[model samples]
Target: MEKRLLGVIDATAFHEGLQELTLHRSPAAIPFGGRYRLIDFVLSNMVNSGIQSVAIFPKYQYRSLMDHLGSGRNWDLNRKRDGLFFFPSPRLDHPVTGVGPLDHFAANIDFFKRSEQEYTLITNACTIFNTHFFPVLEWHIASGCDITAIRKGGVSLGMYLLKTSLLRELIETRHETGYLSVRDAATDPNSPLSLCSYPYEGYAAMIDSVDTYFSASMDLFEPEVWNQLFPRERPILTKVKDEPPTRYAREAYVHNTMVANGGLIEGTVENSIIARGVKIGKGAVVRNCIIMQKSKIEENCIVEGAILDKDVKVERGAHIKASGKKPYVVRKGTVQGAWMNS
Candidate 1:
């Protein structure tokens, strides 16, 4: 059954609310959980589910995403037979919409036609969850539904499972059917196709805005949430770099924070998520913050309830604070000087 499934990810989403982060890359490539990209969760889930063939359709800025996923080797998807496939959209003017836009899929229709998979699992690239699709396949098959929409608490999770033949039909007749994407066909109440809902009880979070992203990042501090998403049996995979273990100074004090590899901590940190290769200089206080890779918070700086993107620098004695729910976002590779504290 796993061999019959093909995983398709739509990585073209551009959320206006997350423009600060998406200015340089697609939302799918946004860093998350200190060490993983947003696409890692779903991509890893597909690989873990024994789906050998996976295709990603991306648009807008996707260089970072391609770099992070590189040959799909970390996930063991670099195969000569059926492995990772990348199709970039040619329609630059096409509006970015929900999962599996028929227009985008139509651009690479030949790949779909040549594939041997009987069923296709379509999903968005930015949702965070840890679950296999085998059970959903069983439910769809048993229910005799043409499409199964994976839901949690009656809300669509932007995941769909349907026959490959039906998907091709929808793509071919999208203009006539008035369905712009697979999400459209599966979600429309007046559609003629049979639809089923599969309720997933596990924890799921969709990152559509800075607030939601911050909330989800902070949630990792909870043991239950962390355990559910990072279970040993089905671990979330990411690009691995052989960086030295994080180094901590004797004066450094940390509690309730998730710090990634190759970081140097020399300050007081609490309830934050610090990504790879970050540095917190002596006497700095970072609380309730999300600091991305290689960001440096220099001496005596006080940062609270903020998100510093990769390569950001905070000059000495700078004070940055904002609401935890709505974090103050510092864009990638920017600098925060002491004067900005005014």
Candidate 2:
């Protein structure tokens, strides 16, 4: 087990262009694949690698996030001490506003000061990839680096390991100055922070926008992507839901689709991810779509190239058309069948 260590899930910035999917939930808590949340990838990695304690910093629309994460029992961090911790925004005292990296840490100063953990593993909640942090920690230890970050394509996944004492010094000593763009500052030659980068050779997807989210969602269709993400060696953990196997009627036609448990398919579905408990009524045609949990498509409806949020109900005999450039989306729990377009 990776003892004397802590995890930080930084979701202090709003992810743009997610539309209805992020209306009432943080992007991290947004559903992915057939049944997992976007945050599950990171959380699963943390637990899989034997790191127990974690503190999640939620930004906007965190209600659903709270519900999903609960007590973090799914990840098995529900211990008597040094378990899962939820830190609200520092601005929660006054009014709602944007949170910077400095403020983000300042709010949870106690976590840094009081935790027995020597090393802090900081990471963003939206980057999806399975990884073991122990090796990264070993690398940081061997290199004597002040900060070790995992990067792919010039973007730091925020998965970094640094001495807790160093992080505390940066916050308390530099209290007057703000370091929101720490990534930019890390690249400065004059900066004293000894930074190192670790190359990630795996399926890494940053779901910050609808375009990337759609692209990554579609990528799950590929055999290579699916195998690497949900490989036999490492299993992604999430909140448990005992849903029965998906039932497809005799006339139902599904091709190259991934339907999760409790789904009832009675129509034609092609090249889509149908999440848990979705109901595709008879004569409906769903193609190139991501229908999230518990959404219903009534009889004879034609849905193509769209993303439907949780509990959305598309009525009978309606036609909703979207494209890769612009996907038509129905907001969460909003009854919008033929209501509008993207």
Candidate 3:
């Protein structure tokens, strides 16, 4: 069953308003939901659908992406045959606006040609959602189209389920000036490719901008969105870490916060999402914030409507807030001192 379907993760497809999150990594590598990278959602979707053969082609700043996905063992994508493949991660320079996943497909044409899977699923790595692809694949097989793409929220998620031979043809002919964007090729009226749409009703979030990222994080405060993402039947998979339980001191006053494993909390946290291994000292106040892994909020500091990237440090008594509008993002590995305004 696994060999019949191939999964492709185009790691460089989308990045806009994500300058802060993508400074050191691609958009797919952006951390979300406290414990999972943005790509984890799509990868989990692929694996949970019973597809074993997965190939990921990441663009520049892909080391972190590689480190995170590893061999895809956590998703049970590790096998001698029809297993996970981390394609050649070449560092590339492009126009200021950058190109789409066309390059990814062009470079991996050999892989597409070699795979035995009858159908291929290609997706960008920046969408946050939980969905099973098997049903969609079945519909695609029945529809008899060359491609069946998931359409929701007035936008195609850059997710396509295609016949393997058709995809190979697209890639082989991609050198033509007009065929670079897969969307254009699929939708062209004169083209021989038969493209159709598959409706998707599941909860989905496409993170193209910083505002979307922040909003999606806060959306977790709603039980519905949280349940949609962290569904009981299929879990979002990521690389595991070995750390002790989060230790909360008696002084910790946490309310309405989703704190991951292995942290030390001794502060006032309300309406915030705290990642694993974070430290909130006594007297610190965090409100409406998303704190990433291993960040530290010292005593007396106040963070409101902000996002703390991984390994950030906020010195004592500092203040960073968005005033109920924009959310200030503390870039990865930033260290703010006593006097700070953001």
Better candidate number, 1 or 2, judged by lDDT: 1
Residue pairs that clash (backbone atoms under 3 angstroms), model 1: none
By TM-score, the candidates rank as 1, 3, 2
Per residue, candidate 1 scores C-alpha lDDT tens digits across 1-342 of 657999999998778988988989899999998999999999999999999899999998999999999999999899998899999989889997678889999989999999899999999999999998899998899999999999999999999999999999999998899898899899899999998899999999999999899999988988899888999999999999999989999999999999899999999999999999999999999999999999999999999889899999999999898843578899899989754321
Instruction: Encode model 2's per-residue lDDT on 223-297: one tens digit a residue.
Output: 888888887767899999988999999999999998999989999999999999999999999999999999999
Give the per-residue lDDT of model 3 (tens digit) for 197-292.
999897888898999998888898888988899887989999899889899989989999888999999989999999999999999999999999
Number of the candidate with higher lDDT, 2 or 3: 3
CA lDDT of each candidate?
0.92, 0.81, 0.83
Sorted by lDDT (best first), the order is: 1, 3, 2
Alpha carbon lDDT of residue 328, candidate 2? 80
Query: What's each prediction's TM-score?
Result: 0.98, 0.93, 0.94
Consecutive 10-residue window with the lowest summed lDDT within model 2: 92-101
**Model 1: how far residue 244 lies from native, Å:** 0.2
Stretches off by above 4 angstroms in model 2 are 92-100, 181-185, 338-341
Candidate 3, after superposition: displacement of residue 63 in Å? 0.7
